[model samples]
Target: MALDGLDHMELEESKGGSGLRQYYLSKIEELQLTVNEKSQNLRRLQAQRNELNAKVRLLREELQLLQEQGSYVGEVVRAMDKKKVLVKVTPNCRVALRNDSYTLHKILPNKVDPLVSLMMVEKVPDSTYEMIGGLDKQIKEIKEVIELPVKHPELFEALGIAQPKVEWST
Candidate 1:
């Protein structure tokens, strides 16, 4: 009976030990899985951080480029291939336009107003009158029609406020 009791006690001890080992093994596996998931999450966040950092770096570079003062300050002397130009930056130096610098050239077509100066009051140069020697009859006709109204002004009173205005042609 003593030998049987010893064998029974050993059998119970083995069962308990096996059960504890299995529980510990399962816990270790679960902990390992949790650690792996956390590590993957950390790696994903790090990668996203790296991508965002790269985009921020690009934006900073672009801002720096835009903020830089333009070195070319001159007229577009001539155009070349692919939006390039020869610019006169100074009295002596000529520069080739680079990196799509067309600010000056692009303004020329829209900025010019040829007829704007016609409203200005000006004296007719004497050299222009000296050039009209052969058109004697025509000049007399012109002086009668144009200068008569300006110099005399009594003719318009006879016509009764119907002022004669000459239209100029370009």
Candidate 2:
């Protein structure tokens, strides 16, 4: 009788041990799956962070270039009131006019003020001083006042004087 009882107890313990092992294995698999899912989520978030960082770096570089090249003024001009027709001056000092279609038309000028108003913007002349026959003396005087400084800037610098500016009177 004692031997039979001992054998029965051993059989029950063996069955319980097998059940515990299966349960442990299932738990480990579930934890591993959870860890894999979390890792994938972390990777996706990191990729988004990297992409945003790259975009911010590029924008900062572009802003720095604009400021360095004096094109920041153009940005300010673009930020003005939408109703006002503003003339945009490029960093290279080109005048940008708006056409009938509301498109920017870049016009190269011999000289332009960056702060010139839209009302003050004028079309480039197709005529020259020689085209006028009787204005020789007047043209010579105009050349001395205008062309002389442009042709020989050092002369004006030596004289410590700037070129004469003509102001229109109403």
Candidate 3:
């Protein structure tokens, strides 16, 4: 019997040959070695990832601490800039006034009385007075009231009073 197409087929196993078994065992060993090398590479990559995560966590904690410290320092600077003003009318009497962040203090002798006065002024144009023509009498009265302190400072001082100072400009 002549087998033309199946001439090259191996019949080692059917013939109980040890050569075929040895070839299969060698292939298995090669595959196991390849698997071990791949597993070691995967472990190295995982360790690198874990180290990066720890560094990120440390940086976040430092940033939070710095922000808290900045707020505390700001509050301390504001407290230091606060102002308190003190005024003394006599040896037994004193007065104080505070502006935004400044303090003013005044002291007077036993025979002299200290008088302090605070005034607020709003600036308006002279044309505004002409526009409100019907308020001529009212405007005059207001002007007199505003000038009373300048015209009679001695009288105000005799009454133990301090007049509000005024400044007018264009």
Q: Give the top-scoring candidate (TM-score).
A: 1
Clashes found in each candidate (C-alpha, N, C closer than 3 A): 0, 0, 11
lDDT by residue (1-170, candidate 3, tens digit) is 77542342355555665756766788899999999999999899899999999998999998886665211101111223445223332334333323333343333223342342223335544566668878888998976677667777787899888788777443
TM-score of 1: 0.39
What candidate 3 gets wrong by more than 4 Å, as runs, is: 1-9, 66-69, 73-170
Per TM-score, what order, best first? 1, 2, 3
State the lDDT of candidate 1 residue by residue for 31-123, as single tens digits.
Answer: 999999999999999999999999999999999999876544456567786656666655333332343653443232223255877766598
* C-alpha-based local distance difference test score of model 1: 0.68
Q: What TM-score should be assigned to candidate 2? A: 0.36
Candidate 2: the clashing residue pairs are none
- TM-scores of the candidates in the order shown: 0.39, 0.36, 0.34
Q: Rank the candidates by lDDT, best first.
A: 1, 2, 3
Tell me the tens digit of each residue's lDDT in model 2 across 110-151: 455557755573885678887899989999998888778777
RMSD of each: 19.8, 20.6, 19.9
Candidate 1 colliding pairs: none
